[model samples]
Target: MKLALSALGLAVLTGCAAVSPQQGVDRANDEAAGFTQGALNLARTQQERDDRAQKTQTLLSAPVGQKEAVQLALANSAALQALLAQGWVDAAGAAQLGRVANPVFSFERMSSGGSLDLGRALSFGLLDLLTLPARQGIATRRIEEAQLRLTGDVVDQVTAVRQAWVRAVAAQQTASYAQQVYQSAEAGAELARRMRAAGNFNRIDRAREQSFYADAATRLATARHQATASREELVRLLGLDEAQAGALRLPERLPDLPKQALEPQAVASLATRARLDIRLAQSALDSASKAQGLGVVTSFTDIELTGRRNTAFDADGTRSNARGWEIAVALPIFDWGGMQRAAMNGRTLAAANQLEATVRAAGSSLRQSYSAYRTSYDIARHYRDEVVPLRKLISDENQLRYNGMLIGVFELLADARDQVGTVLAALDAQQQFWLADAALQASVVGRPGGATVASPAAAPAESASAGH
Candidate 1:
């Protein structure tokens, strides 16, 4: 009786030792502090919800930059909330593996020939108590895996918000430039039409001006739509309500490029530090190895123990009492648990190989992400320092010549169009750099954001041809 009571008490204590959902959430936030900026939260109560809503509202009232956008999404996004909730569920389920099943209770009463019999039994799985330590070790590893996964997920979400903000702001700047191009084309076409009416311009020149005006109009429309689409994408990422969306404002332009790009040596050092991917893989391998060992004994057989008490009363005023226990063990005659052992062995092997693969690929992924980031930064800097300035200088010279009557109005208008095209291309280069920067930030922390470096010259070349 003392032994049985002791085991039951131990099981109850083990059950109480599992981590609570709040603790899991707090752990994830701490581990992902770089991405979350210590702002990750789950609003479980009305007061929390209201506080989060107020924070989001305060952020939305400003021209949301990259960091503000991430903050807004953390506070407002329903998808992010669902992700945290699922993380809590996974952690709780993993903790359950460490707890023993509740003991079963049975009762019976029988009457025959003026005699009554009463019986009671309490039964539980004995192997579960024996394997408690091993199971708890596996549960601890699984919980660690859950926390790392949540951290990686938060990094991914924040990277997405950063990239979307870049796109939204860049699109707005591009659209504003497109409007300038349209106005320049409109003026050139109008002047050409008046000159042709006065027999001062040729039909071919007038037609060319009109065609350029039409093309500019089309480009303007496309740019406007692109701006709208990018803004809406940011709005969705932020999980804003209709009212909040209506109130949302974005920065006027993308941030300027950093004075110096990230150093390769610095990137290498950061990549070598503890990464979420490597930790997760190691945790998985540990769990599989633990579980494999645990299955060796459990798969072959199981044992159950039951304690019982019985009392009987006879019609002749005679009574009897009995107290004892029962033991049940499963036999491995027809099934030797061979298949179960094989499955466990296979899982361990797979986990080992997966960890190796993750370790091997980590450096290469970081290098590729850094390459894209550095290349984008260089191209954007070139445009800002060389291309845009040269175009502006030419525009100024043309304006001076036009004022001195050394160039016609048509030549001055053409120069203006070329300068606007160059500026638009510069805007695109800046946008790509910001996107790549966001991706590199994620990759440094072991989550890749898939941003790539695009050709910085493509837009400007196309623009030059269109102007001609």
Candidate 2:
């Protein structure tokens, strides 16, 4: 009886929503519709944003040269926004002055044998007079460092936006190629089906062709999804929303790699001088070095200034404000400066050691960047010169052979597939190389600084559309 009931339950569930043609198609269509609606909404927002972006883009017309990818990134990037917020802190701090709280006041009265006597006094001494200048100097230096660090952050964030923009373009191109290949495969599959109907092709050929067409279609859809994802990523990086980022344009090609001498030392120095992290560290080190003097001078030493007022009771018990000043200094009889000096010296040395280590690490990173830059630049060059040309030749040859009847239709199709694969590979190689080049610049010059300093000689053509 239990087994029969279980079988009935399974039947009811399966009858309603079994994973069959109708159910699967319905689900797929629903998901596709959801994605389509989302995209349409995003497009609508984009149109609105484009209006504002156009004005901003106009200001950058000369620099970006109508490059949509760069225009979008410059308009949208959040990395830059973060840096800008951080910069506000520096700007605010620069105008700020450090001030100590005012001294406290208190009064007390006591009853004596003859009459109640009141006490009153005034005093102002906690941190010594010598320390204020030193402290203020420290604060002022910190402000300078903050400003420098802010500048570095701006440079780094701008570079990151540029990098994201370039990647979006590469991903767009890749997806576009996939789309074309899928369309061609679909056409070929349709032709093969017609041939099979006429009895010129067997069932096996039709099935294989159909499979190829399906595979290409799947790949194309996947590519489209990824391209959209990449674009979204670019929008987020640029600090745009669905509304603000929608109107941004991206360039079809990446910015050209600058041709300059890649010196390890020079690059490392730039990082040390410009990177926000290094500057922040340097400020910490400076603060620590100055703090050492406090411990040695403060041990068992009481430096105080005092003012007192006392009233005298005579025959009539008269009251008067009699004030006097007194100063006292402690004698460091026990500990002396031994332990304090030792501690201060230790901290000072530790901070110095850390600064040295950081400098060395920055240098090593620069060297690594140099190596990667050279390797990627070489590979990118090879792909453009050799791999791309060879793929084109093979594709042309296959077309000619098919026309001359030197190869079967199947062979021609195979060659076309191979050519597509090779071209895609070449494109990937090119993107990788350029990305590495950008990374190399990031390592040495700081991201934002690199973009500013390594401006491309002439911007690439702004020929890309939202859809290929």
- Candidate 1, residue 94: CA error in Å? 0.5
Q: What is the lDDT of candidate 1?
A: 0.85
**Highest lDDT scorer:** 1
- Root-mean-square deviation of candidate 1: 2.3
Please report the TM-score between candidate 2 and the true structure.
0.67
Question: TM-scores, in order shown?
Answer: 0.95, 0.67
Q: Report every candidate's CA lDDT.
A: 0.85, 0.56
Tell me the lDDT of candidate 2: 0.56
Candidate 2 residue 257 Cα shift, in angstroms, is 6.4
* Tens digits of lDDT, candidate 2, 1-468: 743574465344323211221222232223223111211111125674576456555633433321343444434444543454555555445423233223334466777677666666544444443354454555555555555565444445444555665667777887888888888788878988998899888777777778778878877787788778877776776566665555555565555544554565665555536444465567757866766655555554756665566665544677666767667677778758787778778877887887777666665666666766666666556666777788778878878987998777776776666666666666665566565656665665433222111211121122111110
- The alpha-carbon deviation from the true structure for residue 151 of candidate 2, after best TM-score superposition, in angstroms, is 3.2
List candidate 1 segments past 4 Å from native.
Answer: 1-4, 460-468
Q: Over 4 Å off in model 2, which ranges?
A: 1-82, 87-101, 106-122, 255-281, 298-319, 325-350, 446-468
